[model samples]
Target: MPTILTVPGYQNSGPGHWQSLWEASLGGVKRVEMSSWEHPVKAAWVEALDEAIADCQEPPILVGHSLGCLAIVHWAEGHDREIRGALLAAPSDVERPDALAVLRPFGPIPRLRLAFPAIVAASSDDPFLSPARARILAADWGARFVDLGPCGHLNQASGHGPWPRGEALLSDLR
Candidate 1:
């Protein structure tokens, strides 16, 4: 089976975060460890993602949130690797001023078309990227867009600790 690499946003996904729970439950899931979660540098994060994909024994299915999703897109702009698929969740709108200070550098989303299949899951009520913006991203990346209704940020704060529905969506991609 291909590896599922879970990439968390800034500050990293904590214990109760759905990504962490999914990693614990899923057999072939691994967390892509970034150099610094406090202060994210785009180049560093992109490099780390490249390294993660390179290290995978099989083609990897990327699963990312917020800044992590941006990192994946940024990496895709430069390199096309052995990526089987991707699952992007709750991508932050770097264009928004209220987003984390570290995320500002990633403004004006990059233009990309993923070589492999991908799905972008966006919450209808997410504070970051609006549903329309998420749809645009999915279109640009040639990924399927899924609207997770009323799910705020789709994080622990949104009360989604397990996120079984997301897992099911990911399974469909496989």
Candidate 2:
């Protein structure tokens, strides 16, 4: 079975976040700890991801949220490594004015097609991206798109604690 790698957004997923709950519940799931979560540098995050993928005993299925989703695409673009799949949720638009302010280094979100089977999930009411934009992005990356309606950012404040549905989505990759 493939391992699961939990990749969190800018500030990292807090205790009540679904990613954290999934990690705690699932064995063989690991988090790819970035060098700096507060001040994200794309290259550094990509390198950390590369190292984590390299160290995996089996090719892992990446479970990424927000900026972490962006990082996964960046890593896939440069490396030839084959992962089992990716469950990318609520991807933040780094090109947006607000995100560009904090995520300057991750500008120019990759539009290249991913080498592995992947699914990109987006919420209808996510502050970071509209459902249309998310669908377009998923198309660009040749990934299956899932519309998770009205689930803002799909995070803790969105009342997604434990998020069994999201976990089921991850299981699809396996």
Write down the lDDT of every candidate, Cα atoms only: 0.89, 0.92
Per-residue alpha-carbon lDDT of model 1 for 67-168, expressed as tens digits?
899999988888888788889999988987687777898766786788988899999999888899899989999999999889899888889899988899
Top-lDDT candidate index: 2
Question: Candidate 1, clashing residue pairs?
Answer: none
**Residue 133, candidate 2: alpha-carbon lDDT:** 90
Weakest ten-residue segment in model 2 by summed lDDT: 98-107
Instruction: Give the per-residue lDDT digits (tens) of candidate 2, residues 69-136.
Output: 99999999899887999999999998877765778678799999999989999999999988989999
- lDDT of candidate model 2 versus the reference: 0.92
Return the lDDT, model 2, position 129. Answer: 86
Badly placed stretches (over 4 Å) of model 1 are none
